[model samples]
Target: MAQRLLLRRFLASVISRKPPQGRWAPLISRALQTPPHSPGDLTVTSSQARPLYTTRVCSTTFNIQDGPPDFQDRVVNSETPVVVDFHAQWCGPCKILGPRLEKVVAKQHGKVVRAKVDIDDHTDLAIEYEVSAVPTVLAIKNGDVVDKFVGIKDEDPLEAFMKKLIA
Candidate 1:
């Protein structure tokens, strides 16, 4: 009971003190002066501006096995060069090489993008590209195949390959 009375007295004294007047006082007052709104009205804060996930978000690499049409759009028609990775689930070398290639490609920033295709999932693309083996990486530019390599490559080889593609 004593603590509660003391706290109340302290709060009352603090409340009686006026805040310092400044140039921002009018803006603060205006922001605090919210008018009546309907239930459908929406309010957004800077923290809630962007979504956690968005389709247009850029990434170093993405899967292209779902839609071949979109693959053509992203790779062939792209203004930037694209690296096409043809791999399969059962291919041991592919598992080792995919992430390494993505890491190397990321260093290029927006100069290049990677479109990964699972040979098992997209057999048509594999056959169309004449991919006879797994871990076949192709560098494409201006809708044409520029450079290619088959099998797993180490970090140095991968970096060199990406450098050639951007050049």
Candidate 2:
């Protein structure tokens, strides 16, 4: 209960760009920094009283294969659209396209999933999907291959390709 109140006060003060004035000001001010300050010393400034905690939301938009589970899970099993990245480690183009494709898929913000299938690691999947070349990207939805590109694509075109899938 107290922590919630303190957080609310802190956020409110941060948004308002003013100190949280009241009986709890001293406590809140002390929690904001090391070395407690007296009640009269309570002053909230962006630089002096910023959020001490930080975190990054883990990404679920890339790499979903280490075994024979197949594309059904990431495609048909999932109602959302998925981008299947068919590539091989030795392929020079695959190295460049992987991260670019990931960034494009990530821009969709959970609306899409990027499933990477390494041709060498999962040769069956590659052959089944007719991935004759490395860095062959296929957009799948409801178990159907919808769209694709055979090699590396620049940022704008890649984003457009993903945006079409979500739309």
Candidate 3:
């Protein structure tokens, strides 16, 4: 009798066709895929391998994927000062410097942005930028190279250098 009553109640609820309410509503809607979800599909596939430092492939924080045109568009033409890090995968100093530079850049907030260029991926850009070394950093402002350093600088010196660029 209780089972029958429960079945009848469930049938009545389904027949009413009213929208789900409260906490479980979202889970149910998501499971059914009946209602539209905004922000599109936020799913990452196994085939897509993101970097260890960043979650998304295209991140806005410090590491940027700037090709020839993107480099100009985002770094060179920007109102804010830009620090272009020219590096390679096999470089030891670059691996060390990349994170350290990012930490300092984060302290500056919106004042500065870092664009990383993989020399192996974009050999043309490396040659154009005249990056003979693995860890070459360039500071750009007003569409020109204002300052630059070609080595793995410690946190203090790098921070000081960054300050000079923004100042």
Candidate 4:
């Protein structure tokens, strides 16, 4: 039953929707059709993967999906500064960074928003932002990309990063 559901999702993503166009259209299109194999490709698939971190921060943290419209509404249009985390389900470092990012965002007590973007589900976002790797965090303000970083960061750095964004 699970396998069938997974197949449905895969087909819907690939067949029903049209590919986004832009400078990265060709690359994104190719990637969608021929996704690269993960290190444990045989044992794990992107659909089967779940986030290792699950701490909630008072609706301040939300997942961004459905391409440009969603991102524009949640992140770009948000009154508060947005910390956009571009990560993949199968990424190891992302699992560690996600919770920590949430924790730091929560400290602000709604001053900032944490927007999680699954690179696999929103390749156009990743490509638009020039994200070449997983676990990239961007600080956005008033629909503009203000700051960004890649890879996992410790609590102290994460705190400082948030501070800078809000400041």
The numbered model that scores best in lDDT is: 4
Query: What C-alpha RMSD separates each model from the true structure?
Result: 11.7, 6.7, 12.4, 18.2
Tens-place lDDT per residue, model 3, 120-146, is 988888898898988999999988999
What's model 1's TM-score?
Answer: 0.65
lDDT of 4 by residue, 80-120 (tens): 99999999889999999999998899889999989999989
**Poorest 10 consecutive residues of model 4 by lDDT?**
43-52
Q: Provide the TM-score for each candidate, comma-separated.
A: 0.65, 0.65, 0.63, 0.65
Give the lowest summed-lDDT range of ten residues in model 3: 43-52
Tens-digit lDDT string for candidate 2 (21-108): 8898887666555345577654444454455466687564556565456466655577888888888779999899888887777778
lDDT string, candidate 1, 1-167, tens digits = 34533443443333323552588756544443334567775543333333233366568788885667977888889989999999888888889998898888888887898999988888889998999998999999999999999998899988888888888
lDDT against the true structure, per candidate, is: 0.78, 0.75, 0.76, 0.82
Q: Better model by lDDT, 1 or 3? A: 1
In Å, residue 150's CA in model 4 sits off its true spot by 0.3
Error of 1 at 167 (Å): 1.2
lDDT of 4 at 139: 98
